[model samples]
Target: MYEATDHPDDDVVAIGPADYPHVRQFVRPTRRALLLASVKERRDGGGEGSLYLLDAAHARRLLAPERPVELIPIPTAYRLDDLTFAVVQGLISADNALGADDRLLDAEEQGLEQHLQRERTVYAREAVPGLSQVGAAWLGSRFCSRHALRWLTKNGAPSALWSRAQIGEEVLPLLLFRQQHQFIDEFTKLAAGGDEQPGVVLCVPEDVVAASPLYQRILFFLALAWLEMRGLVTWVCGEPEYAKSDEFVLVPGEQAVIGTWMRAKDNIWSADVAVRKAQVRDFDLSVRHARAHSVTQGGSSHARLRAAVEYLGLEQTWGTLPRRCAELGAYGTVDMLQSRSRLIALDEVDRALRYVGGLGSA
Candidate 1:
């Protein structure tokens, strides 16, 4: 958790654990990451997503904090990629005043427009074939209008460009090539039968998903979900991050990578969520609007009682795995990944809400 003095304008820096020495020791060219606010798409065929690596300085300024922002250094052995740079740079720029200020907004807006025009021209000449120059312009225009380009290119928007670029570069390729969808369609066709009950859509949890190629396949998930709604195969969501369980399908295709993420998700459980696993640390210090009140409750109060019961239930059923792992002294980074995954799980969220609801009912 962050300290109380952190200011809103302060930078929230994150480096891989490997990169910590660079910030701590001021070593050579250590890579660090910062987050900007989230962004949404503004055009048709556009879906909600995030932009990244646009403007770092601006992000540091706009998202002020209550404590001095610290950089999170990641482990160096973790290979870096081009997409990482694209994300970090875009996110940083998103937090800048140039993005939000109305006075200079037009200039920034024009620059974004020009960048899109250039990218489209490059894509047409380099990406599409058999199109004459004039024809290419028309085709590109049809693919994305000036209005759409303007919406996508606006640099200040968080995650807008990130998600679009990802959709364009990764998801569209998979969908258009029919590489993965062939399997999806096959499953869908199989599901239309009267005797079939389509199984859960299997996937690694989001963190593992983020680390894996599946991150790029988010669009594929969305598209397939739509297909499933039309009587396609059922999409059962799975956790690639945890040990393969009977209730979920394990994604078996990730052997190509080093399996670092898989190892991370299977780490031993702890009595509480570990300190290093704290993903969101809210630091709010504004003097309340004179309407703040403190509410006290006992540990066995309705909220705690239900959460404890549900948590104990999960522990009783699934506890053997973690307990066995812990007995073997297998604590490691996977604990962090698993805890994070649980924090984001739909089932976990629903369970928590139900627990709270039960408390109110009681």
Candidate 2:
């Protein structure tokens, strides 16, 4: 959508006929997010999750194409969080640099021993409205702040004091007041009441929108997916800018936010992911990775990612893998495993693998 004229008044963006069966994903504020990265036990009884509006700049910088992610050093400020709060530190992301320069690393760590706290507050990071960063916008709107709230804030505005509650503000409730377990279930819950509108069209003030630029729009889609479960569909328009004739906040056939979230949890039928969707994207790669680990170590690897691996043709030669369910007397290419006595058609391999399931325990 354009930044100059588009404005959608409807609850859901009116999708066009040309755009059918399309889905879109939501984006997160690149600079920060209220992540439930750690859990702290409450002295009272139940444990409370520690929410961090993780500053992703260092992490993003490490992954920048210009430098090798492994070589880059995480700022002392980030490392300090791990030592002090006893929270996750060193590498927030898997792609982050593991080792800092030995020469200054000790000094940096020593100096930060006392000062490496939430050196920067949640207030320091300008977040997009409607996302978990919504905490800041919601809180700040009720009071006067030191920095100018972007009519969306990407131009570099400072925010207020940080608080963990802000990050858990929205997500905690969605997950039934517990740390996340089933992401798809959490999002889909919004539709449970059956009041889900086809989609939600956000009418955000430009300042409330994220001011940061995302190189990977899929990140936005990942976050947007969470928003989609609220309705059968999801659309967004930032006003004036997206209110154009040819453009929409997003339109029909236009990728709807609802399908985007589904894509994250469910495998696709066609299997060609979006270019931005082109790469793997998730709100929390760690959580998904953990689930993957559980699936694998728990003796379910054959059922988990192997199908996607096969669909992508990453491990085997598609037509060459031999399959003999010999007991059933069917012998053919892996794609034709079900062909009783007939030859398999290479062109139809995708269709054959479409509904494929677990390869069974190793």
- Please name the candidate that would achieve the greatest lDDT relative to the true structure: 1
Reference-based lDDT, residue 353, model 2: 22
Candidate 2, residue 32: Cα displacement in angstroms equals: 18
Over 162-269, each residue of candidate 2 has an lDDT whose tens digit, in order, gives 111111112221212111223223323332433222232322223432342221121222222233322223223333442221101111121211111111111110
- Any idea what lDDT model 2 has? 0.22
TM-score of each: 0.20, 0.19
Report the lDDT tens digits of candidate 1 across residue range 1-362: 11111112432123333433333333222223322322243123377533322122322332345533454322211111222332222222322221233233233234434434332222214333333332222223222333232322122111100011112122322222222234334434433342433332222334433453422332333232233233433222232322242111111111000001111122210011111212111101100100121011123343323332232222232223222222212212121111111101222212222322333335
Best by TM-score: 1
Q: Each prediction's Cα lDDT score?
A: 0.25, 0.22
Error of 1 at 42 (Å): 11
Q: lDDT at 14 for candidate 2?
A: 19
Question: Where is model 2 poorest over a 10-residue stretch in terms of lDDT?
Answer: 157-166
Q: How does residue 274 of candidate 2 score in lDDT?
A: 17
